[model samples]
Target: MRIVIAGGHGQIALRLERLLAGRGDEVAGIIRKAEQGGDLREVGAEPVVLDLESASVEEVAERLRGADAAVFAAGAGPGSGVTRKDTVDKGAAVLFADAAVRAGVRRFVIVSSMGADPEHRGDEVFDVYLRAKGEADAYVRAQDALDWTILRPGALTDDPGTGLVRLEAHTGRGSVPRDDVAAVLAELVDTPATTGLTLELISGSTPVSVAVRSVAGN
Candidate 1:
């Protein structure tokens, strides 16, 4: 399989890239800086530098052309304020989906937040971030042309992955290792049966593959 991921330099994305390439899949990562290309290459993923915040739909679509799947893993990152949340989280996500539609990439995945809701009310920066993610998720869910699955993981930790997880529509609040999240994403990208599902992820007793298969079956 050929897979393209936005925010290729992100921690979870890097792990995912390594996993995909190790499995002999052709993987490409979209980054904002040329310097990040070497890191992607180190993990056996081709690097495509394209700023989704400013790139046109046609430009992104061109990059996505012939891709088997696309994953929206981009974000403004820590210390970013409200405006960037909207631009990177909401605007860029919508743009990537549009590009996917134009490129005819049916399978799409988004790394979202647990409480992401367009109706979520608050005033802090985290509040704005959730709203942005929620709005972006709403747009993707509305796209009839795409088979999209949104994975909303709980708090992220750097702990080693146990390869077990609780993936469901409402897994409640918990912490999950980035490794486990990436592992689940790897399975999700391959499970087209998971289409139209917005799943929550956290550490659990069930193995990653089993959890994914169970969700896909549902």
Candidate 2:
């Protein structure tokens, strides 16, 4: 399979590149900086430097040529303000979906936050971030042209691979290793049943491969 990963330099994105490439798939990573491209190349991914924050939908679609799927894993990261959170997270996500539609790629997997439900709007201190992610999720779900699956993982941690992951709709609050979440994303890419579903995943007692296979129903 040919896959395009946005935010190629991200920890989870790098891990995903390793997993997908190891499976002998054609993988490309879209990054916003040249440094990120070099890092992606080290992990066997063809990197394309394109800033999602300012690129047009057509421009992104042009970069997505020949991709079987695209995964939106981009974020504003630390030191970013509330404005950046909206632009990079929400705006970029919409751009990706639009690009996917134009490129005729039906499969898209987006890494979202656990509490980004549109119905949960409140005056929380992190309201900006929450609303940003929430809007992106709603846009993807409402689009009929794309086969999209939104994976909402909880507070991300840097723990080593635990293999086991819990997958379900609206799974309660919990944190999961970033590695495990990547495992889920990569597996769901190859699992068609995961399409159009919003899954909330966290660590469980099973291995990552096992959990993915269970979700794959094979």
Candidate 3:
């Protein structure tokens, strides 16, 4: 399958690229930095320079041409102000979906935060982040023509992947490694049953690959 990943230089995006490329899938990543292009090429992925904040839907769709699916994995990153959080985290996600619709891309997978649900998220300094994620999640779900899946993960860690993961409709107080999260994203792309579903994930006793397969009763 051909896959397009936004924010391709990120740690999670790199992990996903490696897994998909290893499986012989055609992977293209949109990165902001020119240097990141070399890194993507080293991992067997074609890299395109696309800035989400400034790119138009038509432009993004053009960049995404020939891809079977698009994964929205971009973020504003820590230390970015609240406004940037909304622009990158929420606006960019929405823009990508719009581009997907315009381009007639049927499959989309999004990496979202676990506490995006207002009922589940408590008031805190990160509330802005949560709300932005929540809004983006809802936007994806509202598109009927698009086959979309949102994966909500808890606090992110940078530790080496344990591979094991837990998957459910809702994982309260969950935490997951970034690598594990990438693995799940790869699985979901190929798992038809994962489409149209919103899932929450975290570390578990079973490998992430196994956990992802189990979500669809495989």
Candidate 4:
């Protein structure tokens, strides 16, 4: 598989890259910083430096061309404010979907948050972030040309992955390791039965492959 990951430098994205590259898949990571390219190369992934926030749809399309699938794992960091939340999280996700359609990349996997809802009500920053994620997931689902799966992981921890998770249509409030989240994304890319499904995930007893297969009914 040729996988292109937006926000290639992100924690989960890097983990996913390593997993894919280790298995001999061609991987490309889209990053905004030139220095980040070396890290991707070290993990056996080609690096494409382009700011998704400013890149046009055609520009992104060109990068996505010849790719088997794309993952939208980009996000404005915690330090970023509300405006960036809308632009990076929501806007970039929509742009990537458009580019995927133009590039004829049919499969897309979105890394979203647990509480994301279009009608969510919270404080200033958190609410904006949720709405951004919610809107982005909605946009991806609306793209009839794309086979999309949305994975909404609960509170993330830096703990090492156990490769075990609770995967369901709704897993309620819980926490999961970021490593496990990346593992799930990698598995989902090859699970065609999971297309068009939105699943919630958290730490649990089921192994990664079993969890994914169970939810996908494979």
Instruction: Report the Cα lDDT for residue 81, model 3.
Output: 78
Model 4 agreement with the true structure over 1-218: per-residue lDDT tens digits: 99999999998999999999998999999999999999999888999999999999999999999999999999997889999999998999999999999999999999999989978887699899999999999999999999999999999999999999999999989999999999999999988789999999999999999999998887
lDDT for position 41 in model 2: 83
* TM-score of every model versus the real structure: 0.99, 0.94, 0.94, 0.98
Write one digit per residue (lDDT tens) for candidate 1, span 1-218.
99999999999999999999999999999999999999999999999999998999999999999999999999999999999999999999999999999999999999998999998899899999999999999999999999999999999999999999999999999999999999999999999999999999989999999999999994
Name the candidate that leads on lDDT.
1
Over 1-218, each residue of candidate 3 has an lDDT whose tens digit, in order, gives: 99999989988898899999999999999999888899999988999998999999999999777889999999998888778778988999999999998888889999988878533365454788888888899999999978999999878999888888888897777688898998899999998777888999888888776887777778
For model 3, what is the C-alpha lDDT against the true structure?
0.88
Q: For each candidate, what is the lDDT? A: 0.96, 0.86, 0.88, 0.95
RMSD in Å for candidate 1, one decimal? 0.7
Residue-pair clashes per prediction, in order, are 0, 4, 1, 0
lDDT of 1 at 167: 97
**lDDT of candidate 3 at residue 86, scale 0 to 100:** 82
Q: Looking at candidate 4, what is the lDDT of residue 22? A: 94
Task: Sort the candidates on lDDT, descending order.
Answer: 1, 4, 3, 2
